[model samples]
Target: MSFPAELSAAAQAVEARLAAAIQALPDSRVRAAMAHGIHGGKGLRGYLVLESAALHDVPREAALNAAAAIEAMHAYSLVHDDLPAMDDDDLRRGRPTAHIAFDEATAILAGDALQALAFELCAQPEQPQAAALTLKLAQAAGAAGMVLGQALDIAAETAATPLSLQQITALQNGKTGALFNWACTAGPLMADADPAPLAAYAKALGLAFQITDDILDTEGNAETAGKRLQKDAEAGKATFVSLLGLEAARARAQDLITEACDALAPYGKKAESLRSAARFVISRDK
Candidate 1:
């Protein structure tokens, strides 16, 4: 399905900005790896960032910078996640994984460079308070948040047995939800929004998105999912479906989506796009 017109337009603008930023980088193997990871995909995380920004009345140009920053972090994570040390996948977004497209060493370097670029993009002086808010994004996507989540995920997969439902959810929250949370929170954070409500909305939507992702991984196809299918089960990774059964897991995802929408209600009609995006998260096939 297509995103809302505003979201789609914002995504296009963000993609253009990101491409320009990447092109300006020094030409090298690392830049090539970064480009490979960033060029494909639907730009879903970036869309989320822009949509959330619109919800808070952020200007389109400012929102585009935030979108680019979030996408950079996401692309970096995907490159690292596909490495041999991580998921060891051979394909991503219908193309060779970064480690396969480039050597593992180059892929690793690319991920690192992308991480730096994410912060750099955020720190750019164009937007007021961009530097401070970009640092916040770094902390959210770095060792304390997404990185820690990934460490737990890798351990869960390699352990003698799978993790419990709670453990798995926690891991997914950190690895996947942290970035989603950052995407939503970054816009509000940059705008100096009311901290309590902004964070509540971001956290709820982040978890909701991840639970829906678990559902899709179980039932989605490699072709449409843009990655391997049932790979979580093959890896013996604990998931909501594995613990709660498919139907129950689906129900829980729906509940989370409802909670996410509720959290945004206080934002009133301004949050319509964000509300729609939340529904799309749960309803998405991929």
Candidate 2:
């Protein structure tokens, strides 16, 4: 199948699984909030999870659940990220953000509930190891990691002097790459594959994904991006593009993509989907 076709198929499968999970929620408001956050997004993280699992020959049914879990976590993060205490944006996916669409308290509760649901889905009967992997994801997304990065990001915006490139990269790795890494690495965990190499590949590809995002925000249109454009610079946030300039940042992203592909060498043809997904990271318009 072609890349776009494959991505669409994966997206559909993940969406179905996510919808089912959302329907099973006990509270109507929480379910509505979760669906609003998840139902119409780009599904990039879901695509990544599915592609990574496919790379290891995981069954489509199994991959769908994992993809759904990953996307649930991603949606939760975005909902929280747009809360008044975080990025404070009023728009996402070309619509009012969760906090704006609902109340701030509802949005916050939605984010928290979705996070718990992600782990709960992972722990479901079909995949016992998913429970352990979910713990890993929590560590990556929680206060010591993504949350810490976000805090630092807000601080950088308030600081008189800009953060160093190294510090900025660290923040990007935590805030953005950590979840991508989990999405990729979780595949191997679910498949009972040896995880060392997969973990390394995930780390490299995750950073590459963030670097490319930084580059895109500088060159992309707000309409295509589904959010405000140039807000990073306006907010005085540190980014690879801001630190290294577009050309150098693009080069760095390419280098990381190369490293990510190289890390998958041992998997041979099994890794092709992941390789293509990595290339897509830099090639995407939105």
lDDT of each: 0.80, 0.80
**For candidate 1, lDDT tens digit of each residue in 179-214?**
877787766776778756556766777777777777
What clash count goes with each model?
0, 0
Clash number for candidate 1: 0
Model 2 compared with the native: what TM-score? 0.93
Local distance difference test, candidate 1:
0.80
Error of 2 at 78 (Å): 0.4
RMSD of each: 1.8, 1.7
- Which 10-residue span in candidate 2 carries the lowest summed lDDT? 124-133
| Candidate 1, superposed: residue stretches over 4 Å from native | 1-7
Could you tell me the lDDT of residue 134 within candidate 2? 73
| Candidate 2 lDDT, 154-199, residue by residue in tens | 8888889889988887887788777877788777777777777767
On a 0 to 1 TM-score scale, where does candidate 1 land against the true structure? 0.94
Give the distance in Å from residue 185's predicted Cα in candidate 1 to where it truly belongs.
Answer: 1.6
Pick out the ten consecutive residues of candidate 1 with the lowest summed lDDT.
Answer: 1-10
